[model samples]
Target: MATETLTYGNGTSLQASNLPLNGSSAGKPVDIAMDARRVFEVLKNGGLAIVPADIGYGLVAIDPKALERAFVTKQRQPHKRHAMIGSYALHKELHVLPEREANMVELLTRDIDLPLGVIAPLKMNHPIVQKLGSETLARSSVDGTLAMLVNGGKFQDELVRLTSEAGLPLMGSSANLTGKGTKSLVEDIEPEILAVADIVLDYGKRKFSEPRPSSTMIDFRNVEVLRFGACYDVIQDVLVRFYGITLPEDPGRGANFSGHLREAAKR
Candidate 1:
């Protein structure tokens, strides 16, 4: 497929917006066919797209080179790990859990409003992670843990399905540069990042505010709160309200995977 090449810096960005602002479909949004076609072309060709995410737009792609390009565009450090949004099917395949907790973990992370990330140990080799990013990939290989995001929404599910069809799990990171404030609005993206992306899917701004963060991340093995970014309060309530389970403030008490918890430069 010949991809429509878009470049930036002359004056304006070559946006893959819903519709050309002044054309025949000026006021009409880009139909699903055009949208999906662009998405397929970007991922298939190692191109990058800034697509809508649960919290904000995300730098999405299945190609390793595209992922690496995102790392550069975000100005993110090499030590940061990129989280992936994938189907329950892929989640079940990649994350190896004890029989007693597998189902429970799935219940906690999937089919929810707040995006949740599960850090599960790899049951088998996922060479695809190498393409996702190096900083986190190197760390995860040593730690033996991978963070997987499971989104149940139809839109996100479609992307996951597409990734599966392509034979790779979809991986992405919030489109924000490190240390800068997190941004959910399309207009908030830095020019440098926009310039590098092959396509920018700009529908509009997001609804959530500071209180709302990206997916709340937890370790899959023990259900420890890795970071209370998004839906931290609601998830905590959901655990106890429905399942009669309460997370330990210090889930590290057992510390089953100290190697994973500890920094590994010297390991």
Candidate 2:
């Protein structure tokens, strides 16, 4: 397979390999570190990039202008906030939650090996929280809380690690126009979203392409179901069987196309 240079709004061009990173029989081998580093550099320097995760592809940015561009490109609503690309370490340091709620997060991300979009109160004085300047903070947070993805996938984990080390918070949403549904494959991502990205990691199709488009987002404050997304069924079961908390049944995509219980949750 050949490598192609992908250029985007930030005027940065990256040589994206058409092959998968691991030496799978399907294609040639690419270096995950090298690719992640390049994407991190682009994002760190105020550029937008689309990267793959287990649940879906996402568009991430650190610059306020770039973040605004992403929102415009997606035509996302004003009320929707971008989720933070975060790790357990980052979550422990930045999110403020009760003991049981925090334990639930640990159980889901570490024990069950599930990905989650955790919405919780932010530790306002945390260094990483302070690092996200005012504009980024305003765009990424809703009220006093912020949503962060935990254990998304190998690629996202690496990216979060990089951002954490650099003291730069990465905030983004699923790489698709709002309401159009999350995209699981880089090739399936809309060209409009791709065009706004400075670099894109085309890591073939994501792992969880069925059941949902993105990670199941829960507001830890009250365990509200903001979005019934990927791995939702398993998450719902674990919460009930272990924590004895039952989440509302998914109405399926037919009734709730986006799977967002916004009205019921009042989010």
Candidate 2, overall lDDT? 0.82
Q: lDDT per residue, candidate 1, 45-88, as tens digits?
A: 77887776565667777776777788887877667776677657
> Which stretches in model 1 have alpha-carbon errors above 4 Å?
1-34, 109-113, 126-136, 139-142, 207-210, 243-267
Error of 1 at 236 (Å): 0.3
Error of 1 at 161 (Å): 0.8
Best by lDDT: 2
User: Looking at model 2, which ten-residue stretch has the lowest summed lDDT?
Assistant: 1-10
Give the alpha carbon lDDT tens digit for every residue of 136-157 in model 2.
7887888899999988988788
The CA-based lDDT of model 1 is what?
0.61
